[model samples]
Target: MAGFFKRIRAGLNTTIGFYLLVVVLFWLKTYLTYRTDFTLGVSGGMQQFLLLVNPIPSALLLFGIALYFRGKLAYWLMLIIDFLQSTWIFANILYYREFSDFLSLGIIKGTGNVQNNLGKSFLEILRPGDFIVYLDIVILILLLLFKVIKIDKRPFKFRYAFSITILSFLLMFAEYSAANANRSGLLTRTFDNNYIVKYLGLNEYAAFNVYQTQKESSTRSKAKAADLKSVQSFIKKNQVSPNVSYFGKEKGKNVFIIHLESFQQFLIDYKVDGKEVTPNINKFYHNQHTIAFDNFYHQVAQGKTSDAEMMLENSLYGLPQGSAMVSYGSSNTFQAAPSLLHQAGGYTSAAFHGDVPTFWNRNNTYKSWGYDYFFSDSYYKNKPNYNVGYGMKDKIFFDQTIPYLQQLPQPFYAKMITLTNHYPYELDKANTDFPATQTGDSTVDPYVQTAHYLDQAFGEFQQYLEKSGLAKNSVVVLYGDHYGISNNHRPAIAKLLGKKSVNKYDLAQFQKVPFMINGSNLDGHIDHIYGGEIDVLPTLLHLLGIKNDNTIQFGHDLLSSENRQIVPFRNGDFVSSQFVKSGNTIYDSSTGKELDLDNRQKKLLDEQQRFVNDSLSNSDKVVYGDLLRFHKLKGYQNVNKKDYDYTKKHALKQLQQSDRKHQTSLVDQNGGKSTVPDFKTNAPELK
Candidate 1:
């Protein structure tokens, strides 16, 4: 035992042994960060193994280059490279803690303001646990400084160094193969950053992001007007004629788009222990003035809420891999609803949400969309206990929003995003008297309580709007952003839905989301329309009396008799009035059974599939190629993003100036009195 200890200690003193030590330390740091700090969403043993091995090649490749040098220079280079890699991991750790996202290459190269982006001070970014990253480095430095270790002067042959570098490249390719085999399209159809970081190391993910960004920039530079020719032709050929009766029904009215987070359609009148889940929204669905769609689905994938927003505003499909909103929204040219209504009609547009402006890259995207103002989390008090899931509780959010709503210029296009009903549905007891589902799944139970709380908040806000008189003048539209219960919790979902099992077709049906629109003097009926998030823009455009004949929108007005009810989801699968295509097997939409199709029916299905594929491909071309920049619209101009700013100070100034100039604000109409006191919430956080 004594001899073994001596030999081990002696070997560690050598330069090669020290290099190996650095590699092992880097690997440990990365794996530990994956397990402890960051959530790359490791699912099973395969994913765990992938995460375990992905860090090996980067650590080897980075430190192995130092082996080509000799003596102190080699050791110093290895140490510096190790430190820089650690710094990057540390930055992502701090960033992931706040945004639940890795630091983008844009953020890394653009600013030194980490504190500003994370909403943390310099010291707050550094937690006590973070010191673990530097512990190994500190120990090595101390050993060298105290003369406990001597610099090694051994000659590392060229063949050995070359072999190490080559081994790294080979191992990296092997890792990519394993990742793709585990999950096909792991790289090509990249969905979440977490998947990339999990399958490949953080260093590899960073490299891929740089490559993607450069590729997109090059594509944009090479874009031309001719690229939009096919897209324009397809859109014009398939345009739906508007219904004369419904056209201009809500023209010149204030447009209110309520973004309901993680809300699904089944929750309407869904009972938990004989209590309603979303009673208020249910009531509004049956309201005399509300046109509700029972078959509306939210077509979202990796982008989720951001994807829904992209389709809602632009009438364009989100990218298949990642969110177009975060990937291209800042730079892409959008003929969006906000700008169309603002330019074509004399309307002011604003978006209100209790989250950070940087969430979904909305701060820049909103500017590109020609929004007059964006009211983000900084505008609200956001006091302690006020934030639950993503941002401020919905009740508190709506209450805080009333003041801003009153201040916006009248006939405004306002979108308020609610956050209380988000996933991992947690809530303080005071805010919800509704009991959670007794199911064993922790993530699936509290959903009802949070959803019920949102319903209460919506009810309170609607009544307040009525009392404040904004309800009478505004076209209030509310829609669920996406599904709260994912497919993984199928057993629990089946039990709640009183189903023996939820098969693939049933799961496809589960994608249905709630969509409704209401306005004064509108004899609203339940429209049995098969539509998705894509159809929202054209439908709203027609109602608002905005002409879009020359535009390149892919969606049709839901009210139009000629609307092709072919709703393509983010994935290749699509839903239609007659059938639901899950993978390759088409199921009868009503019965959820495989279709025994005749010859003509098969031909029709094939043609429908082709249309869906082309729609997705053309949308991708328009986005990646940025085809809109070259095409000119008659009355439209590119949004001067420089004209808009969403900071607290500038937003306030902009609102006040617009109000002074127009004198048509709600506050101005209400005799210069604020409507803040009218709205109330039972949120115990407020108490």
Candidate 2:
């Protein structure tokens, strides 16, 4: 035993031995972090083993770079590289804690994605054990300086270094092959970070992200005008004709888009103990002034809220991988609603959210969309009591927006992003007294409380609009961004839905979210329209009497005679008026039973599937190929992102300067006086 220990100690004193030591430590540290810090959804013995071993290839490939150096410099180089890796890991740890997901390459290069509230959020996420990520580095540095682990003053042979590099390549190939065998086409299939990190380590994820970024960049770089013709042809072929009954009904009306975060359509009139959960939203949803879609769904992928926003504003699908807003919003050209409405009609576009401007890269994304003003958390009277887990409390957010909302010009397009009902559904007791569900689910129980609070806030907002007279001239649209309850809490969801079990059909139904358009002049109808978020832009354009001729949009207006209403989920799963396709099986939409495939039924299903597939593929092409950059709308200029700024000083100054002569704002129209005093709310947070 003593002889073996002595031999190991002697080997450790060599430069090659030091590199091996560093690699081992790096691999171990990464594995430990993966188990402790991240929720990669490792399952089965195979997945567990894969997760355990994924770090080695990256560690070997990276640490082996120091092998080329001679003497003590090699040891120092390894340690320095170790320090950088540690820093990167620690940064991800902080980010992952808050977002429950890994950071993307775009975030580092974002205008505010990395910098916005980074200090406060990062410090809050930092735990005592987080220091351990770098503790090994500190120890290794000290050991090297103190000469406890001596570095051999020998030069590495060229063959030895080359062998190490080649070995890393071999290991990487094996890991990738294993992952592919486990999940076919693991690299190209999905963009969900958990799947990526579960199969491959963080280093490989970063490499993949860089590759995706470069691929997108190169595709855009090599894009030609001819590349867009096919995309345009596809869009034109699928073009939906506007319905004569509802076309241009809400013309010249102020458009208010209220984003109900984490809300599902089942909650529309859902009751607990004979009491409505979202009383206010339920009221607006069913009222005679609203055009409600009972079958509307949100089509979001890994991008979530940002994806919803992209589909709503630009009528384009988000990238199958990472957020298009984060990846392409800064540089990609867009014919978004904000810019389109502004240029087509004399309307100002604004987005009001209580969160930081950088959360979904909305700071830059909004600029690209040509929003004239962005009323973020900074624009609100932010108090300690007013804040919630995600951002400002819903009631306070609505209450604070009175002044900003009043200042916006008439016929303006404003999107209000509510945040109180966000994930982890933690709401302070003071915010609402709504009873928690009896599901005993940590996630599902408290969801009602936050959702109820959002409802109350929405009610107050509607009342205020009526009192302030904004309701008379404005058309308000409400939508749920994405699914609040994920598939992980199946037991709780089944209990909540009063089902014995939650199957794929039930999960498909869970994707439904509320979509309503309320306006005083419009006839109310609860239309059973099977449309998704992608259709929002075209619908709104038609409502506003704006013609969308010679433009490329993947979605059709819901109130259109020609709309076939085939809503495709991000995962290629689709729900139509007739059938719901989940994985390999198809279910009847009306019966929720698996289709007994007759020859005719099979043929019809196959045709619909092809249409859904083609629509998604063409939309993706528009984004990846930057086809919009080549396809220009007649007399409409693409948005200049630099012209818009989200800062408080700049937004206010521009609003005042530009609207000085026009006197077009609601406040200007309300006798050149503030109408905020008329708005009333009983929010406890305000008190």
Candidate 3:
């Protein structure tokens, strides 16, 4: 026993013990600083201290055991374990949804300070004060004490090395199992069974079990096909095609649609530095027949960027529940805005983005959307690489589009998606044309500078339009795709603002992005209609003097007096809407609200539900390839007068036959049973 004690003591005096002590102390210091952000009362303090200290004891026990048995091999093994654990933890935290939200701390209530401080580069913010210097020193001292005083005399051992290798393998296996368990649960909840199995790699046995359960549940509660058919019939009967005046008449007009990357409304506010940050956009807003939707909101689902694009162009609702862009990309049949316009008005359309077309499977989606051509980073020539984080410079993007515009036929629709304002706002020095100012952090300054530069680029584009004589005959629309939130200077931002709020939603202004429309031929007056990205296509169609069947649109035109209000829906529920008529009653999905069904309210609700069902069903079909193949559906030619008479009769006969067969099939399927539940009697009033 005495000799054993002597051996343990000797091991503690080795370099292995020294490094383990250093790491533990460092972790402890970091945890302490983390806890200081919140003031813990006595009991809370004790709990926190214990929580933080428990890891130390556990680590020490493992380290001590390894050191006593393994010697030199144990030390190297411990280092490897520490590295793996730290890397995993950091990756987990970084990728977690909540991490990007730290940018909201700097936003003032009234000022539109939408500039994200989160997107700055690592080196730009790397400085002496960037780390907790005092805590670091304390950790160093603890490490030195363990190394020099306690663990300097230990010798190497083969047995200890073997023990560490086995332990490390076990530890890694355990960690991986825990991570996989959580991921599996998350995937099952979010995605369909087939999707989970194919894209998420769920084992066949587990996936089959989930599939069987879902299938049984669906069978028991599924709406009858007959009832769905009746609902569709009702919608078709009540559906009125909008006789929009501005749609097809404005021929030979160039249409420019700029989808700004993360340009939120909060960023539109003039800063205190006497410089107008978004001057170009503000100027365009004032000079055009603009409608600034103060209550505009985005319904960002899984594919935040692509969702915005789909909603804006196609007037489609947000992505279906549990749709990850990666998985959804594999499916090729999603209907969208450009295709509809192409079919209706013979408008030549092209889509451009400054990133790789394949980034979000946009190349496929765009091709499916009837875009005559798609331009991306590869499309541009002699372009300066702007390390603006995401892609080519917005300035160069606009410049490249100019030649294309001049060469294209009249009355073309060009969609330009900018990238200079993407996250990690710090523009690579190679990308920026402006001189960087000292803003304590090099990255933050570049972001602000990039915004200024983007504003300039927009102005130049506008000038180009005017110079080319297309300004007077062009319709221009601009909006942000999503908000940026990826910077490391969040702590500093919180300190600068004297508040500690995190996440963009916590800040009301982060959701607001500028949506504006300008056209010289149109009236120069502002419309205060509430709208969102979903309304953009309908509104644009209205402005272009092009009227479609309108039965397909879930969104209303801003210019239409019949439905002037916009109702924003997000996450399987309505967020806000002027069109939703309520009688001193609030309808919330989370907190049940008893929907008081007054006559008007009932009518509106019924209409909305019908619209929702049709849209959802059709959109689902479109996305899943049950509808026409997106790529093949293009190149539709309109019949001339001589052929129109014959074609019209044939079309009418086919439509009638199709409708009759569809109804008969529904009747056979459901025995003519109504699936519409009696809302007044069956469902409880949502409070």
Q: Residues 417-468, candidate 2, lDDT per residue (tens digit)? A: 9988887676776776888899987667888889998998898898888888
**lDDT tens per residue, model 1, 1-687:** 999987866877887788888899889888999998885557789888999989999888999999999988988888899888988888887766533567766555433321123343224446789868877788778877886777788867879888999999999999999999987887675355777898898999889988876776688788888989999988888888899999999999999999988899989878988988888999999999999998899887656688899899998888654567777777888889899998888899999988878777888888889898899888899687998866789988988888888988878999999988876576887787998887676668888999989889999999998889989889999999888887656788788778988877887888799999999868979998799998999999999888778887878899999988899865567898888987546898877889889998889888877778778878877989988887799989888888888888988988888899999998899899888888877767777
The sequence of per-residue lDDT tens digits that candidate 3 reaches over residues 1-687 is 999977765655666545555456545643553343212121334343333432343344344454544444655555555544344323222322222311111111101221223234333333443244244444444554566434343564657645655665554344334434533442323232222222222122233444533443353234333433443344355333444455554544667888878776655654525566678887777774654554565655535676788778766654443232333333434445555565665555677776665666665556556566666656566433442566767776676656444544445688888877765575655444555434465444455567766787788787766655666767788787765543234543343234574322223234556787777666555555556676777677766666534234456666666663535444222333423322223353223344556788667666664454454544443443323232233344321212211122453354345435544321223344322221111101111
Best by the TM-score measure: 2
| Candidates 1 and 2, the one with greater TM-score | 2
- Per-model RMSD to reference: 6.1, 4.6, 16.5
Q: How many backbone clashes does candidate 1 have?
A: 0
Q: State every prediction's TM-score relative to the real structure.
A: 0.76, 0.82, 0.57
TM-score of 1: 0.76
Candidate 3: misplaced stretches above 4 Å?
1-89, 97-252, 318-326, 383-387, 428-446, 485-506, 548-551, 564-574, 577-687
